[model samples]
Target: MRTIAKLENVSKTYKLADDQQLEVLSQINLDVQEGEFIALLGQSGCGKSTILRIMSGLIKPTSGTAYQYDEKLQGINETISIVFQSFALYPWLTVYENVRIGLIKRQLSSSQEEQEITEAIRLIGLGGHENAYPKELSGGMRQRVGFARALVAKPEILAMDEPFSALDVLTAQNLRAEVIDLWKNKEGTFKSAFMVTHNISEAVSMASKIMILSSHPGRIVHVIENKMPYPRNEKSPAFLALVDEIHGLITTLNLPDTPKEHPISKAIFENAESKAFENIPYVQISRILGFLEVLKDDNGRTKIFELAAKMKEEFGSVISIAKAVEILNFIETPGQDVVLTELGRKFIEAESTNQKLIFRKQLVLMKLFRLIIDKLTTLKTLAEDDLKVEINNRFPYENADKMVDTIVDWGRYGEIFEFNADLKVFTQFEDSV
Candidate 1:
């Protein structure tokens, strides 16, 4: 692949007025190929915008160098167009004048300059509104004016900094589609475009490549190649798989602790049966768990109430305590917290909610099922952290988790006695179940 722009070990350090230096970017190396769409993604203060500014020639890199290739060997190259979140147009200038500003400055003749401005306005879907001023336009329309002005510059690289963040969802999505279409049609001519956004879905939809940066002296951490073809489907299994993979990578970076392992024993659920309840309410169940944690066991077997008080002391309230217990299944309330009744204690001791174990089992079962009955995995082991991760990864997809959850819920209700801990390794005796 031909690299059109390269940032070789670039670092940007800002020396404040008080002489306190802040190192924003450290040892950043990135390459953009000709005609490639790349997205820079990270939390705030990750130096994403700083990189864009450096690329636009508006700021200099504190250390190392950034280079852009000129294919035509043109006379010292030309300007790089930039679009910002602010839309940056002069309020006094009409949309037509704003779009014409860059071209006019290049000493172009009147007719040619007007034609360029007209074409750019038309290209960005603002053709008939050229005479409209920025103050009169909606957020989306004003952004289009900014886009038109940038396009009119005819820059070799188009760099945007959260340009659509201010618009409503539908409008931003529409504009994103338009931008992608513009890029595809102008392949070779447009050369390359770079965007910095915090939205994961935006990066997935628009870019050929997505680079994630780690915060605190921001540095590139992971580069994911989005191989799916456009237009991409946010719901497709392939899309979700990629999203989950990226999520897994990102999550691993933020938390380095080795998770507690709790594998399940098949004997815990040896007599499982499927039953569905349609009228379950999560809030009622959450309250029951909350109250249960506050109640002490009469037999000195450890009351959920004691658990609740401990949770409250550590985590703050009955609700959050109940929720945390819900995550770990230290207490089970299916739409209402019923007494532990022995089985609940059994499930908790088994640590049946470990997510990594569950995910690993799901992977294994998926491969096995595909090779056998074309069935989805049913057996899953999850811990507190895994449950949180699963909820995030499985959101808006398959809802397979509901079934895994049903299995756990059944175990909590004393319908089963098996506990599979740490990825289906064993079947242990449940003293309580």
Candidate 2:
């Protein structure tokens, strides 16, 4: 198979305020080849979408090269078309017009354009709704229009960035099946497909090759060649094994304090220390507590995937909650299983006051929170804006305001500090004062 799109030793970094750089992708290399469906899977904010953008030539890598058909790619790759997660439809345009936009750059005559558009609409099961506006369509139908628009151009590579994520589960399942059917049947329209998704099952079901990425300067850590036949049986042992394997890999990648035997924790912590401050996963306090409570109910041990299913939450969200609690030393992820620590059990079982004390002790142990508390200790009070500035100085890659809010939430919950929303200030908690 011919290599269609390739990123060779690619790295992407964004310059933030005060000359700080946030590296998103590090030394990444991948290829889109003919006769292959590729899936990029990772935690949220792991630069999966950025890889899609780079491959589509929507954005240039800060360093390294992106190649298309063995040539250095510049500007947009005419052979690639993308279906965005948000549907990205023009609300004012009818479905037909939206699909027509795909062929606008091509020098097709009016008749040719109409034929292609009509064929794409029909091919994507949007035949009767061509005249309807976006508002008239359901979430699944809107995504179908997105697919129609992407397919109308007859591009060689169809790139979808979480295209089905916004739809209901049933609708997403149906759409995924339809897309796979299209790939199998629609020969020569698109030679390859690349998708960025967080859904392990989705990737397992559809992708011929799955690349797993690590968070915080995302790197391709694992690539699985899925030999399972098309129309995969999710309930089958082979399929379940692949899912479990990927789950284990992703859980290890996301959780820093995995089993000591694993070398991943060393690299993860080194990366954290080099940055001076670890980027806290912006998870709510209640979610962290609730997650621990669930773990307690599970007799303090369960796989992360099982916990996610039990909580009826997405895997990424569950991972974030787990990371937050893990950072506080409330949980230890041994392989795929999250085992509650002694502190975690005690905190969950203790009265509210004891729980707060335990949480406070954990919060102060973290470098980021310790920095804030030390400043608050010396100053007794700090403005929210100043706190945000300090956080931004330490974590240039994060959203400063959002980080401040998370800090406030966690600190207030632990009784380590108090934020007066009305005054827009963070004051030392009364107990500490």
Candidate 3:
């Protein structure tokens, strides 16, 4: 197979205010080969979409080289087209017009362009929708137009960023099947496809190769090859086993104390104050409590995947909640199973007031919260804007406003501090004061 796109030791960093740099991708290396369907799977904000951008030559890496067809990629690669997660269709334009934009740079004559667009629309099952505006289409149909637009250019690589994520489950399933069928039947049209997804099952169902990334300066930690025959049986032992294995790998990688061998774990544990810089999962306290209650109902032990299914939540949301709980030392995710810690059991068993006390104690133990508490102690109160600025200075890569909001919510819930939303200030709790 020919290598179509490659990233060689690429690392991407964005400069934030006050000379702070936020590293997103670290020493990443990967390739997209002809006839390959590759899935990049990781938690949200792990720079998966950034990788696609690099491959399509939409953006340049801060360091390292991006190549297409063995040549250094400069501007946008003409042979690579992307289907965005949001459908990215113009509301004012009809489906045909939207797809025609893909060929905007190509020097095709009017007749040639029409023939290509028509063929792409037919192939993607959007034949009659060409004249309809985006508002007239269902979510699935909109995504089909996204596919048609991407396929219209006859690109060698079709890159999709969570293509089916916005659709209903049934629609997503049908679209997945159709895409796989198209890939299998229309061999020479597109040599390879690369997808960014959070859904393990989706990756397992489609990709021939799956690359798993670690969050916070995303790095490729594990890669698995799926040799399972097409039309994979989700319930089959082999399929379930692969899913379980990938779940274990992802869970282990996300945990704080899994092992120091990986860069993620090293970056997490190398400093005592590292937690201060870590981006706290922006999950609400109620969700964390709710997840714990669900786990308790399952005898305080269950696989993370099972918990996600039980909650009827996406894997990423469940993992975010788990990470929040884990940061408080209330849970321990060992392999694929999330076991409620002793502290967690106490929190669950405690009354509302006692639960608040426990949560407060945990908050006091974290460096980030402790920093806030110390500042509030000395300063009597902290302005929300000031806190946001401090958080930005500390974790420049994260959304400061969102972090401040989450901090206030968690703090208020734990009685660690009181926030005056009207005044836009955070003050120490009266008892602490």
How do all models score by TM-score? 0.58, 0.89, 0.90
Rank list by TM-score? 3, 2, 1
Query: What is the Å distance of residue 169 in model 1 from its true position?
Result: 0.3
Q: Which stretches of candidate 2 lie over 4 Å from their true place?
A: 256-279, 381-403, 420-426
Residues 278-325 of candidate 2: C-alpha lDDT, one tens digit per residue: 678888899998899899999999989999999988798899899888
Q: Which window of 10 residues has the lowest lDDT sum in candidate 1? A: 272-281
- lDDT on C-alpha atoms for all candidate structures: 0.60, 0.87, 0.86
Clashing pairs in 3: none
Clashing pairs in 2: none
lDDT of 1: 0.60
